[model samples]
Target: MTIEPYQWAVRCPETEAKLAIRGLSKTFGTGAEAVHALVPLDLMVADGDFLCVVGPSGCGKTTLLNLVAGFETPSTGTVRLDGKDISGPGAERGVVFQQGALFNWMNVLENVAFGPRACGESKALAHRKALATLDMVGLKDFALKYPYQLSGGMQQRVGIARALTNDPQVLLMDEPFAALDQQTRETLLAEIRQLWQRTGKTILWITHSIEEALFLATHIVVMSPRPGRVRAAFRSRFNESKDPLITVAPDFVEAKRQIIHLLGQDANKEEV
Candidate 1:
């Protein structure tokens, strides 16, 4: 008798997982001065799903990411990954912050290899693996440059490569492209969409840009003001092959419009 490959499904070599957040609530301060950051929010991310979270500035989008990343504790409820409770940061989840986060002293190669090296990989093997990731993000030629010497976009590319090299099942990005120019942001968006297609990693992205959310996400999660809770969720699963430039496309435009609406008609009023 012949045995089958470990992953019967090509899409997932690992066992399918379901991340659950039950009766989650969080508050800051107390009594009259109390601020409710999140209020009984419940969300689930199945294996390989790409979810984008959008909300008003004080809506607790990052707060939610922090809870999931295990950087902070929820005042109530629980965050469980594959039925296990999350008490602290885990290698199962990798994160990329909003700003460019590359080491100024270390060159691009060293910065990208930091995680794997700290995980006990040999120096030669870590750098070797780092090189492969840098190549993936089109930064192979700039591997020797220090963080200060590279442009803002290049620095961000290195940060992303570092996160991707860890092979985390879930990738959490908090406004990762908010710092880049329009053109650079567009380029990186395409790069990320490609990476998602290739790596099949579950991604939870937080962003202020409606187009960006619709472009790279299979699901869009919108939140309301303080005590952030889900206001709306949209499905763009079959919209994968759609180009970002196709924003003018009817479906794309409609989705974009609806997301803007989900943000609340009053937000535009405040921006004005």
Candidate 2:
């Protein structure tokens, strides 16, 4: 008897799954007064997949993110990475919040080195790794600056560098650029796309901006309101488009229109 590689993967998920959420759900409080945050949902984030999640308010997008990050436990089902059940936050996954959550007291170099240091890395080695990661994010020269001294975009770069310094298998970004100006957001979006291309890291990002998702995501998932469920999912080619003005292209515009329609339907449903 001969076994094929793909067949073996079915039997050995640990070798195949980068992150997997199976029938996961979340609810806050208890009984009739409880708030149902997420309906049972299944999602598989394959190796190196850049997945962007978009949804209406109260659709549990952030809850889903937190579940996968292990900051919040699912009320039902499970989240797994490399086939191991996720119980809590671990170095295997790195999260970037909406604002640059940097320690104001720490210099840029210290902030970037913080993760490695927490993981028991020697000071010399951690600082060296931090320098390399900072350079990757184009912030090596800002090492001596404090968080308040840097621009909003620069601080976000430090946040990204800090996450990368840990060498996590996956990145969980929750609207990391939501607070930035439009021009800065676009610039950071392009940089993030390039970084993904260079690193091949699996990412699960939550965002309200459809354009941002269209520009950066290889795959996009749209969720319904309240107890959120997947309303639609798309594998997009716009990210592959070389045009800088891809957002205005016919195909991109059409795709964006369809997503807006879905969101509109959810909004209508919520009102009723």
Candidate 3:
């Protein structure tokens, strides 16, 4: 697929949006004690688009994600998936958390198969699906190994495989690679880019790393500090590049610089 260059404000047509956030806001508590975690914000994610969200700490990035995941109710407005309002969690969305969150007692295969089994698939069918998904993540050989037996990166891959076994339309990932070493994180970033291309799944990813966001996202949304809102949104093509050195390319560097500048402005405002 030929990705277009970055545009400062690229809007996905309403008809093409797989996930739509309209006037979504989240406030904790009531009255004077209320803490606005997210300000009313709108975003549209086109089908098969890899959208990464980045912002300062306490910027409500996770709050926005939770609303879409239907884990929390928005204080105002709604999140719609394929034109249907999201009332609560459903099978259509698969979430990968910061940690593996795998069942410690289950081996890799069992861990990955748990989702399918829960959805009423037969034990045999669930195992088959899990094995295939594990193979997709290059973990077929480690299927029998326990989570504690695997490295942190391998554990994360298992989490991803588990998420894919359900064949979800959208993948919601919250800093899935944040705990890994630099090298492992880079490798997984490349693998994830390939996985997204192959699966063509719409992804809503939350991250603190600007470079990771720039490299993995087809569209990047930078949010403002506290009561977070969209500070800037850009359509980027860097995710299309297969070259390992693409991150160091002049354009990629410049894009990173621009995002840094935007975050710097937020940082200054945060200090005041």
Candidate 4:
């Protein structure tokens, strides 16, 4: 299979973007002690786009996600969701962390229902929505179980179901499957892709696994090491394939190889 060239220019006009980042940068501390976590970067995620970010450690992938999620203020630049500036965390954006951040005291159903409940929905309505969302993640039967009772994979499913219950316009995930075993991670990857297809929600995912990004993202962004910047971006076709073994296809392998090469270069830069 012939490989298509990577698209280095992935930016789109703000008018057409579902999530837009412009000249975004973040710095911690001050003066000589200051740490530059992210450099000025611009990205545009269109509606229903699955955009995955990959890079070497300390490349500010999580920093960028936090900024977009409104968990932290940027040193400069702006993040706009649906043309409105994100002042802070809002219902329109739902975040999933690497570990399942469910409340241990709450059962799976209550944990998933908490978001809607916080938003002032009646308990009856919230429980109904939570049950429906749990069903979507194949965890309806586990509703009465507490986080401690479920396996790690099942807990993560609860995290995902919680995020979906609110019906957010954008989903922000920070290496959400990093803690899972390979088999479980792969299972969730396929499930999440199907979920995305079914919901048509825009997603911004950060993952260190190139295979995960290739298999799940419609667009991939590679960031350079520390003071992270967009080193390269590509529109991937592998995500469109339904075959489980597509990862081994020549073109898929080639695409992965190319990203590995880019990341290798970024590593070399960090060492120098």
Candidate with maximal TM-score = 4
Cand. 4 TM to true fold = 0.97
Index of the highest-lDDT prediction: 4
TM-scores, one per candidate = 0.89, 0.94, 0.96, 0.97
**In model 4, which runs have C-alpha deviations exceeding 4 angstroms?**
1-11
| lDDT tens digits by residue: candidate 1, 128-218 | 9999999999999998999999888888888889998878888999999998999999888888988988988889999988888877877
Stretches of candidate 2 exceeding 4 Å from the true structure: 1-15
Clashing pairs in 2: none
Which lDDT tens digits does candidate 2 get at residues 108-180?
9999999999999999999999999999999999999999999999999999999999999999999999999
**Candidate 3 overall Cα lDDT vs. reference?**
0.90
- Which scores better on TM-score, 2 or 4? 4
**What does candidate 3 score on TM?**
0.96
Please give the RMSD of candidate 1 to the true structure: 7.0
Candidate rank order under lDDT: 4, 3, 2, 1
The positional error of residue 50 in candidate 3, measured at the CA in angstroms, is: 0.3
Clashing pairs in 1: none
- Candidate 1 ranges with C-alpha deviation above 4 Å: 1-17, 242-244, 265-272
lDDT of 3 by residue, 174-263 (tens): 999989999999999999999998999999999999999989998888889988999888888888787789889888888898889999
